[model samples]
Target: MVKNHSSLLQNKEFQYFIIATTILDLGKKLSWVALSWFVYQITGSALSVGIVISASTISPLIASIIAGGILDSYNRKNIIVIENIIRGLILSLIPILFWIDALDLWSIVVVVSINGMLSSFTNIGSRTILPSLVNKNQLESANAIVSMTSQFGYLIGPSIGGFSVALFGEPMTLFFNVLCFFIAAFLYSLIPTESYQSQNHQKTNVLSTDNRMRKFFFDTKEGMTFLLKFKPVLFIAFITFFFNLTYSPFETMLPIYVKDILLTGPESLGFMWTAFAIGAFLGSLLWVKIKRTFIYSYALGLIIILWGITPTFFVYFSNIYMIYTLMFIGGIVYAPYNIISPTIQQILIPNDKRGRVLGVIGLIGGLGFPIGVYFSGMLAEFLGASTIILGSGVLTILLGICVIIHPSLRFSQMTNLDNIKENL
Candidate 1:
């Protein structure tokens, strides 16, 4: 196992891919913070901020369906590089528009929507390309490494973003974001094209435009059908959706909880998130060292149970330090599910169908976040954020228990691709 991991690290193309993804994640996080602050600064209305944020969030969900077909039909490496380049070019307009005093709220929303839509392709491409980069035995380690470095962006991006805005202003901060994306694109381009040659040689093509559209829909339907027929993947996807639904409230309501419940300031909220990011980063590292192969379904259930339990403590604890500690521990438990779930999918899904299947899974799982946030916000207005959060935690715990006891998931374990295909 250690030898495989060491050899995986030695693969220079994989190294470039990881660095590119980390930089891409950092740019996105930084831009999100900068854009949110800028929107609020200009409008002084939380509603405007919500509109802009929702534009970015909702656009990606809409694009994932098309993104899946594009991923399968195109070279994923080229798609990733092109997407990043387009994103950088689009984001450059923000700073330029602001400089010329031509930037409007609507224009910002439009740019963010376009970038968000493009990002779906890059995000899915990153995952689908992973199986080509590393051997199956090294997937867990590769995933953990990817997750760990990517979490580094989450850990520092917002802090740097806020500081950059204060010191350099929104336009400059946005320019910084553009720079990050361009550099990430360059890094991705550094990876030799030959690395993905085997994966891309099987692309499907149609000469007729009408037939291409028809083929696209047909491929999309086929992907969904495969996901439904594969019971274990289907079950995991459902669990992921439920998990997002129950956990999103914790993220969406954290600021209010810090302010009203803990009677703290923005600094305290920052500290809490930082603590969680630190824990998540360490957890990813620890996961890389762990030797045992998990029964993916059972392990996910247990992880979710622990994850749900950690946040429930928020209902009881009023101490800010205690909350930070719990957030840190919660982060640790959350890391494993992210690593295990995708690794299992990559192992089981054939390379030909992998992109579309992952895309459908992405759409199914992604729906929970925006829907949960929307409803949770509405419910919080009536029941209070604390009550809503408590309910989310409890519901999550119940869902985890359901997974553990469910006839399909309970008996499912990690298996080789051949066995999974045979069973299917």
Candidate 2:
């Protein structure tokens, strides 16, 4: 059956899904920026920032498995709508809690952790369902559009979040985030039933069983088996995992690094992150152009190295303008990896197993943060943020070299979509 994707985009339900999701993402980013700043302000410590981030990410990292199972089982549209409402309600309280001085450090951690779990589940469902809405041929373009919106949100969200915190405070930012979620939830309710209904019945016959746990494990096994046979996917997963281990520290510890080493404030941190996001935005927009000029794998490795090392040098230089420029450049290189990694998964992995395989990727790649944050925070406490960043830079550059040396990784299952379709 040939689906009319343009018509689908014009469909009220699809529009709701896209717009609502975009708004939800904006709020999520805003809250995250606010949370980071709030923690840093109160504790006056970099380690505290790392700790809050680690706590928030921990649940999502753990929930990826179960979240995948749920995503595969549930009516995804309903799952997303319900999750957004719940997310909004929970986040709305932060401001009230803060107003009364009732919000403690532990309370923030607990709330953010719960938020992460729900957010992860919603993401799993939303991403799993997107391809079902559009024609197969549109997958790359669709993914690019989604990535573009993400970059746009990142581009604006941090700046707004930063300035909002300066003018309004953490609670007000949290309140604004709650508003975005409400809007998202409302918009999600309008998606057409036809686009989502067919898959439900189709999957039911295969997935319906007496023992869900047994089926869950079986599903997980299938996804793992698929990855085992596909050399490119496996290598990319490992590369993403290690690269994340090096780069995750920047997000977790970068603000703290700016504050502690550079003796800057929230506005400074905001500009720095905005720079990173802008760079990412530029990189994502250049996806088509870069695909022509560079080998995606090798180029991605080099980007990771540049991203890691540039900030190290910029921090040493201590000019905020230079730091922003370098961060922007780093982000430019960093964007393609995000696009390429997920596109590869969608292109290679079977549709039925996407939830679990993506979960596996999330599980493996996500572990980098808690690990990075824990160690980086500990190191920053004793040695300093600069030394830790320099070490990360050296590690990323070495990892890139190692990847280049291995031919299996360097040239594994080269991604040519036309050939992939032909084989299928």
Candidate 3:
């Protein structure tokens, strides 16, 4: 890890990339809290939370499929820079509309929908660029660092956003969000050109004008084809889908649970999320210590199961501190997967197909999130959030157990590329 950090810092380009990513992540985290609060404040309905999230979901799903192709067809650095600029401008509008008293629910939805589309493009550009920035052996460390940074953002951004919402109202919080984006954009400008490649840099389109979409589909097909050849990668993606599904209700409806059932206000609800973020950040740091251990998957499964089940108990008990403790405890297991999953992929996948395969993983992962959020929300309306969350835990535990029963799906003791290849 030290060696990886040294190399990452020694590379001037990567230094800039780190700054850019860290800053952008800050904005991303803050916007998450800000938007959710904005929606809840405006609509005061639980289902409205689902509607707000749908804004992000609809466009990103469509854009993510295309983003993989774009990743393969463009200069990734340019894409990153451009996307940030666009996102900055778009997000700025939110504050402007709010200040003008013209910000309606529909307007917020429209802006966020655009935000999601741009985010897909931005995510693809950045994720694909990582392999090019660092040595293959260091990919795991680099990914770990990135995951850690993200958790750090989660740690700080929501707390700050919550405070901002309380002190300055939602519009000013959004205005600060715009500033964060520009800061990210400026940092992105400092990254060197050597760190990235244009996928089809000089190649002209060979497909007929009408066949462009067909060609795009065929390109996406290549990513799916690669994953189809790898069982571990497929299993991981499948497990991630279910695991993510289990976690979605917390993000989408947990605030409502805190507010309605537990009688906690927005500030207190934000603190609960902050508690989750703190756990996640600490958990991310722990990845550096146990990264080589064989118990990684088992630990992850246990933590996730806790994530699902703990809320059930907390909701009934209505003890905020207990819920907060569980949230933090859950974080310990939560953060490593972010580190390990990407690490597993980097080790397992060749550079040639990493973009496409990761894109497919993103697509599959993406599908699970909205499905989880929407379904859990609907279920909460029919049953209760506690049942939906608890059931999700049970489902995740069962899924992991099933995967473990298949020896092939179990985590291997392999460490490096040679062992990974031999194991696979």
Candidate 4:
């Protein structure tokens, strides 16, 4: 197993994929920190910050409708490369417009919306392409590596973004984000073209436009149908929906919490995120070694329960160091879910239908994010950020308990897909 893991790491294509993922995620985290802070600074409203953050999600939900069919039919590598480059180009306008003093909240929303729509394609493409990059035995390890390294971006980006915004300004920070995307695109482009050729690549001859449209819809339906029948994946997606709904507020409310509750600035916010990222990074490393011992569903339930309990303590402790400690602990419990859940999907879903099924699942799972973001902002406005966060945490604990006791999920042991399927 160790030799195989080493070999998986040695594979040049996988290396490029991991590097590109890290850099791309770094850019995204940086942009998010900068944008969130920038919006808050300009408007001084938690509602406005939520609106801008939620704008990024709205288009992605709309795009997921057909994103599956597109992924299944086209080269995922090309999709990722093209989307990254386009996103980079689109984001460049932010810095430019800001410098010229023409950037407005509405324009920022529009740009973020466009970028979010493009990102859904690349995000799904990256996940659906992962199984092809390593051997079956290496899948779990690859996921661990991906999760760990990706957290490296989270570890560094927010800190850099906060300081950069403080020192240079939001415009300059955004320009650096633009550069990261372009560089990541270049890394992705370096992966051999033939490596990720779509197995379900559809070649249309002289079919009429109407016929093609029908075919596309038919393909989409087929994928959705399969996902409905796959009880384990469906159950997981159901859990994810609530998980995202409850957890998303943390993103929208964090800056507000920093400014209003903690009475601090961007640097403290950056440090808070960095603390969480550090813990998550460490957890990912540890999870890779110990993941074989636990049942999948039970482990996830316990992790979520711990994750929920950690943040609730924040309501009692307002000290900067205490908050950072809670976030670090929260990140540790949070890391495994990110690694294990996706690996489960990869193991269960067929390669040909992976894109469409995952796309629909993503759409389903993501349904709650924008709602959570929008409402959390509103709730925070009335209830206060700390109060809202406490409520969210308590609600999440209940959800985790539900997961632990649920018959369909609790019996699912960390074993082969066939065993897991039977247990479900």
Candidate 5:
């Protein structure tokens, strides 16, 4: 049955969240092309691109951990709105520096790190807000809407960014991103926090610096204690660690993939991304309808296997159209993992401790990815991008197969949300 997605928009609060997220997605997509091209052009070295991007990845991980305290303690709505404005102002520096031809590599690295950390600081609140905005029955549907809008932006933004670089340059592309963040922030400001149902029951005094630091560590410890008792969360942590570890090398190697293996430019890269987004859009929509009977843990392993095998063929495909088709197919398998993992966290974790628990999940994935990125950079330099990516892909498939046979994951599947809430 075709679900009425329009009804989702009529819920004013969820509507506001979606609008803000969609705007941010557009900016993020534009920045991916514009900034990558700008850095590569300026430095003429793939290793430099790896360093800047790895910094962006690592900084955000650390911020999410630190922001755990803020998400559980402070006024989340106020922080998000203020953070968005700050992020916009910080990002505006890129275009300004580009205009003056004063964009140095180290300066760009610093800007990306600062922006990454602050951006994650704000997003922790928004990420945990979906359960409050929508009814439980509609949670999957709401996540699907989020995915669709985000992919819709990806479908449009990258092509425009890639073309605009040849037309108006990276400065104009970055300028577009600057506008999106500010506008998204305003839309966020309209959300009424009086309606926020999530709250931390424990009180902490933020008055003294020493007490505040102590409080932050205590809050984090409390969340970690709760997480340790839950086996499913640990299951996710295990797979996510391996998943991000294997996935990182491929991500860090993408520029070389598009350039060397595919023998293409940004336009082709844009087309590949558009294909991935379209698949994700449709896959997310499909999951909402099918998630009732879904075996959450089993499906996760299967998705990983599909992801691993698809890329093996992708690297071998000679025709560009064939490569695009494989990328699109890969995206469909990939979308379910993104939707399921977060939805389960939102469902199982207590609203009060959700921030820190999510922070823990972020730390696990983050730790693996940067380590993968660092080694991938060195490995790709010695072994070539093809060998590095292919090795990662094959190992991921084996890991998924091992997960399929594992007693923990096979038995870890939740019977129902009612059972889940009772256990949790």
Candidate 6:
């Protein structure tokens, strides 16, 4: 059990992972702003940007199974090293293509799709390796630290990116992001396999059979079966599907909202995202104390309710300051959900099954993103972005209310309390 969160860095590999994650996240945000604006410029339609973003999201629906199986079968360190290196290589092509005037909307979509596919491996591997890296009591703190750095990136990266875009142009700004990915890959490469190797926890590999296609199906089935067996995870998955579906469109429409409704430039957009991260950063800081000392069930529910209601207020305001305020509050509500979720999963599942089970969860959650974005784009083309945002807020609230009514989900909120009591 980790008595001090500060002591977490004493483990050298965890230290490397944290540093790598922070560097990558910071660069990723810078690159993301460039990419989104670039998409908007190419097709001159909000719908086109959504289509391009959705192209990446679509692969998680299919590649997740393959990713999970590979993580379980292969060395995870190699997965981290290889995945980021490839993504860095793939993403580097964009700036090169654009420089030669060879970049097109379809080409952008293809690269993003491939990068998203690779992300499943890196993401699942990261989660799967955490339990091996820290004690049970340290999971929340570890995840909280990670969440804080990621939020910090979102907070600061955009402001820098916006100015960079104004100065260096989007393609040049993206090259910095490619470097960030490479930096992360190098950090992962530095992690000694002897020091932080994952213990093979499962006695039998799910894909022991020789029939390749059949192995895929059976492995997927095994993951699904494990997910169903755990009621809390299954329930969370069910509730999140609705919120994520609505949220996907909400996110897809945000850049357009900044331009048309908020009446702002990329600078204001940067501040709005910065506002969110500040709120989320505050929330996560509180979470560290709350998880250590108090009843967290109520905190979880309050966060969910706030998530649903915030957007309703969001659409009524046109002033950028007011929108920034709303974004900050939304970020405050958002942090706990992201930080605590994996901590709960880590505490619940055994070490071996983490990859496969999380893959299934990703598959389930990821399904809503592309489908929602595509349709939302079509509707935004007709009804306008404000209308879509309002409708999404209402639906998100409805899902929150449903989770409140569901007994199992309500019990699931007591999870932190139960863990604390067990420790006592």
Checking candidate 4 for backbone clashes, the offending pairs are: none
| Whole-model lDDT values for every prediction | 0.78, 0.72, 0.71, 0.85, 0.78, 0.76
**lDDT tens readout by residue for model 2, 18-120:** 7766787678778888998898788877778787888888878788877776666556567778888898888777777888889877888888888788887
Summarize candidate 4's per-residue lDDT along 213-250 as a digit string, tens digits.
87778888999998887787898898888988888887
Put down candidate 3 lDDT per residue, 1-424, tens digits, no spaces. Answer: 7777777778876777777777676677677777887888788766778777866776777677677776665566677778878888998888898777898888988898898898886676677778787887777778877877776666777778778878888778777778877777777667676565644533414556557666567767887887887777776787787777766776787767777777776666667767877887777767675546565456555555555565556545677788778777777657777776777776786655566677787777777778877877777778876666667667766755655455444554536435646755
Q: Which is better, 4 or 6, measured by TM-score?
A: 4
Worst 10 residues of 1 by lDDT: 197-206
Candidate 5, residues 293-343: lDDT per residue as tens digits?
Answer: 545556888889988987677567768899789878878888877777777
Clashes of each: 0, 1, 0, 0, 0, 0
Estimate the TM-score of every prediction: 0.89, 0.89, 0.90, 0.96, 0.92, 0.90
List ranges where model 5 is wrong by over 4 Å: 1-7, 201-212, 291-294, 411-421
Candidate 5 residue-wise lDDT at 347: 75
Candidate with more favorable, higher lDDT: 3 or 5: 5
Residue 198 shift from truth in candidate 1, angstroms: 6.6
The model with the greatest TM-score is 4
| Per-residue error (Å), model 6, residue 397 | 1.2
Q: What's the CA RMSD for each of the models? A: 2.9, 3.5, 2.8, 1.8, 2.4, 3.4
How much is 273 displaced in model 3, in angstroms?
2.6
Return whichever of 2 and 6 wins on lDDT: 6
Question: How many backbone collisions does model 6 have?
Answer: 0
lDDT, candidate 6, residue 46? 84
Highest lDDT: give the candidate number. 4
